[model samples]
Target: MTRFLPPVTIALAALVLWQLVSFIAGSHSVSGVVETMAYLFRMMQQESFWLDVAESGTAIFYAICLSMLFGWALGVVIGLNRNVSDVSEPILVTFYSLPKVTLYPLVLLLFGLGLSAKVAFGVMHGLVPICLITGNAIRQLRPVYIRTAKVMRLSRSSVTFHVVLPAILPELISSLRIGLSLSILGVLIGEMFASKRGLGFAAVNAMGLGDGTRIMAIGVFLSVCAISINFLLLEIESAIRHRTARI
Candidate 1:
């Protein structure tokens, strides 16, 4: 209860602000909290809503898996060699700084429409932060750690699982949290631009129809989901840090 209080308070405050804004802007421009929540509840009861959710969820899952796997592998490889890290870091940073939306046309051309496009967009958004964070964390790892692993004659797999992973677990989790959010954003953008299905498409359709209530409801729903997942990730990271500290 205590742990949840701050967020609850913040949510209430945000609601009050939202209602105030809606009142000032008039209902035509912005939906009230109650109205949006009602719409969201109704939306959840519809079969089409669930279908959109399933479509988006599948894409998000695939994107996250690929992003984490490839990002971690690349990060580890780069971090293990100072020369590689120095050479690649600037290029990676430059790419990451690019506005991803600008590349959407290219992505569409490569993957075409549907799940593949959505997943690719998501991977594009998610892959960099994880790689950058993981690589920096690895670079910061004490030299003694690697020397000790080598001295013990540990196999490559064993060393990675026992030493490298544990040492960078906290940073990895942080990267994951960021990557997950970006991946979701990317998928939604893909849906809005290139796909006929998913929550993003629904939101875009709502916008086209001037259905402000539906748009607000979708925004509220996505916000709640993102916040909940982020909170869970933070808790897990904290627990891991505590356990690591004890060890």
Candidate 2:
């Protein structure tokens, strides 16, 4: 069903709908979309846009790595230790439920709206989901592997490396996919709130100038980036699952 529909069809349908709305209602909406596409092309022609993308991408990647490292470790510890899970699960849930963006003022105060602030925001956004998902995934593991390792008299480090880590890696990757998107959003927010350059800066500037088309262009660019990333992640995840199943 999914293959039959094709993702590009959705894009085509959306564009058609957009054009219809613009034509029936006003030219502004249609022109805005076209203008946005033009701006996107214009942006592609310049080096600055690419540079800004790289900078934002770097921030997001860093945040993802940091979150994954910290979150995975904490999740594993919590999952393995009943006492820790009991004590910390609720705390983690509370933080996860709360909107991390609400901490913007505090983050800006501490990090002063620099790259530090952006990284901090990304970390906050990326951490909780990774932690929760990793913990849950690990928690669901059957004890067969552990039991086998114990019966075989495997050393603690060996058992953990050869058994536990592999079992939970897929979960960590799944969490990472979610966290990466969150981190990207965080970086854009940080840049929008206070930064000299980045896609977010472009967006803020567009709005300030009442350049709705440019704003829409920025939005379209972000959407394309997001869709591209999602497709890549999905492919990688599917490959991983297939390989794991074969093993």
Candidate 3:
């Protein structure tokens, strides 16, 4: 219960601020919290809304899986070799620093407009951070772990799976959490631009119609979902760190 206080307080404060803003802006410009929630509840009752959610959800799921798979694999490879890490680190950093939106045209050109484009855009957003973080974490790992694996005459795959991966599990989880958020953002952006369905499209449509209530409702829904997932991941990461510390 105590653990929940900060977030609860923050939420209440946010609602209060929102109400104040709504009052000042007038109901036409900004919806009150209650009005937004009411609109969200109505949205939830529609089958079309669920279908849009399913579309976005599927894209998010695929993007996350692909990002994790490729990110982890490439990160492991880059981390294990000193020469590769030294050479690639600067390049990866430069690429990651660039605004992902700038690459949207290229992604659309390559993937075309559809779920594939959305997934690819998401991977573009997520993959680099995970790879960079994982690679750096592996580079900073205790040398004794590697020496032990070498002494055991373990195969490359065996060493990675049994030693390196387990050792960097905490860092990996942290990178994953970051990557997941970015992937969701990427997918939503994709939906906003060239997609016909999804929550992002719904939000965009609402914007064009000047429906402040619907727009606020969608924003609130996405914010709450993202926050909940992030909190859950943070808890898991914390647990892993604690267990690792104990060991």
Candidate 4:
């Protein structure tokens, strides 16, 4: 209960303030929390709304999975090879620093304007950070750990599975948490920019029609999904950290 206080308080206060401002302004641009919830509840029963949700969810899911798989492989290679890391570190840093949105046009050209484009956009947004975090995590492993593995005559695979994997598990989880959020953001932006389908498109349509209630509903839905995912991942990360500490 205590852990929930701050967010609950802030939420309640924000709702009250929103309602107050809406009342004073007498404008349709901002909606009360109740109005938004009513629209969301109505939307929950709509088949089309569910279809958009499914599309967006599936795209982001694939993006996250791809990000994790490829990011881990590439990051491990870079971390394990000093020459490769030296040659590629600057390139990765530069790409990661760029606004991912800038790549949307190129991604669209490569993947087309379909669901493929959306998934590719999401992967691009998510992959870099995960790769960077994983590479750094492995690079920072203690020299003693490597020496012990070598002294034990562990095969490369054995050392990776036993030592490197466990050591970097926490960082991987942290990167995933951030990457998932970024992937979702990327997918939504991609959908809004080019697709006729998805929650992002729905939100865009609502905005064009000046449907403040629907806009608010979509915003709240996305926020809830992000918070729930992050919270679950956070618990897992904390558990890994605790176990690592004990080990």
Candidate 5:
């Protein structure tokens, strides 16, 4: 399937290119592909590594869920009103463009530099993309659907849940993919800036100590973690879409 082959092909090509470049450069700064991969395998054997991975994963999941829930609700509200959407567009653009990391200090002060702060930071970054995408998708929904639903005397909740939500789901899934990637990056950076233990923390420490192997290893580990989560989410999204379509 193209779905599966594309990732595998890209991954293989990247690995070959990386190995060639690392080999030719002869500088130990960037690790060779094989060495980094071996280190990643070693990391998988450690219970503590999985625990740290789990911590970051849990925080990311919570943040994304909160972001999507709030964003979708707000987007529907704003999108339903032309005047409100127009007035808020500039403000929303500013928030989206601003770097989320800049607010970490304030968040740290409020949430005290723990999982909560990391999760909150992730939410800020994730919510903007989701909200914008959702709003845009809402605007494209057919007026005919609304008219027909009204003529049929559909309840407000029924119209929204049955019609609006289903129509926008494909777009929501796309936004969700983007939001997940951004949240993962945000969570890792948040961990680097503030956490005691995480893959990001390990990478940071490795960099400071000039442990090039560990640095490369941790980078690979993070990549694998990100890839796995993305794949899992994609699978879940596909399954849900199929089930919903059948209904």
Candidate 6:
């Protein structure tokens, strides 16, 4: 009971404040929590809503898989070498700092205005932070661990599999959680820009029709999805950390 009290209290307070503001405005331009929830319930009954969610979810899934595969591998390679990290770190940081949305035009040109474009856009957006976070985590490994690997005369693959990966599992999992959220955001952004189907486009359509309740409903749904994923990932990370400690 105590563990959940704070968040439940804050959520209730926020809903009350939102209702108060919406009542004061007395316009359809803003929706109260109750109205939004009502709209969300209606929307969930529609097959189209599920289709849009599925489309966005698919794009996000593919994008995250690609980003994690390439980003983790590159991070490990660069992180294990001081010279490579020194040369590549600045470049990676520069790319990470850039507005990834600006590259959407180029990605669209390369992949066309289709599923490929959305996946590519999302991968680019998510890849940077994962790569950087993983690199930093790897670089932080204790010198004693490195010495132990060398003392064992372990091959590169053996070292990575048996030592480096386990040591960095917690930080890497956290990075993956962040990466998943960013990938979803990226996919939604791409869908809003060009796709015929996706939750983002659904929200955009609602906006054009001046259906504030529907727009808010979509936003709330997306927020809930993101929060759920984050919570699940956190639990998995926590479990791994506890197991690692026990080992």
- Residue 234 in model 1: shift from native, Å? 0.6
TM-score of 1: 0.96
**Candidate 3 local lDDT, residue 153:** 100
Best by lDDT: 3
- For 34-82, candidate 1 gives per-residue lDDT tens digits of 8899989999999999999999999999999999999998888887779
Those runs of model 2 whose alpha carbons end farther than 4 Å from true positions after fitting are: 1-4, 29-34
Cα lDDT tens digits, model 6, 1-247, are: 9988998899889888888888898747688888799889998999989999898888999999999999899888887988999999999899887888889999999999888999998899889889888889999889898889999999999988898888999988998999898899899899888889999898888878988888889999999889988988999999999998898
TM-scores of the candidates in the order shown: 0.96, 0.90, 0.97, 0.94, 0.89, 0.96
Off by over 4 Å in 5: 1-7, 231-247
Q: For every model in order, what is the number of clashing pairs?
A: 0, 0, 0, 0, 0, 0
lDDT of 5 at 242: 85
lDDT of 4 by residue, 60-84 (tens): 9999999999988888888888899
Q: CA shift at 125, candidate 5, in angstroms?
A: 0.6
- In model 6, residue pairs whose N, Cα or C atoms come closer than 3 Å (at least 3 residues apart or on different chains), thus clashing, are none
Better of 5 and 6 by TM-score: 6
lDDT of each: 0.92, 0.81, 0.93, 0.90, 0.84, 0.89
Candidate 1, clashing residue pairs?
none
Tens-digit lDDT track of model 3 for 156-237: 9999999999999989998999999999999999999888999999999999999999999989989989988988889999
Q: Candidate 1's C-alpha lDDT?
A: 0.92
For candidate 5, give the lDDT: 0.84
lDDT (10s digit) by residue, model 5, range 93-197: 898888878888999999997889988999988988888888888899888887888999999778878878888887788788888888888888898898987
Q: lDDT ranking from best to worst?
A: 3, 1, 4, 6, 5, 2
The better-scoring model by lDDT among 5 and 6 is 6
Q: In model 1, where do residues sit more than 4 Å from their true spots?
A: 1-3
Error of 6 at 48 (Å): 0.8
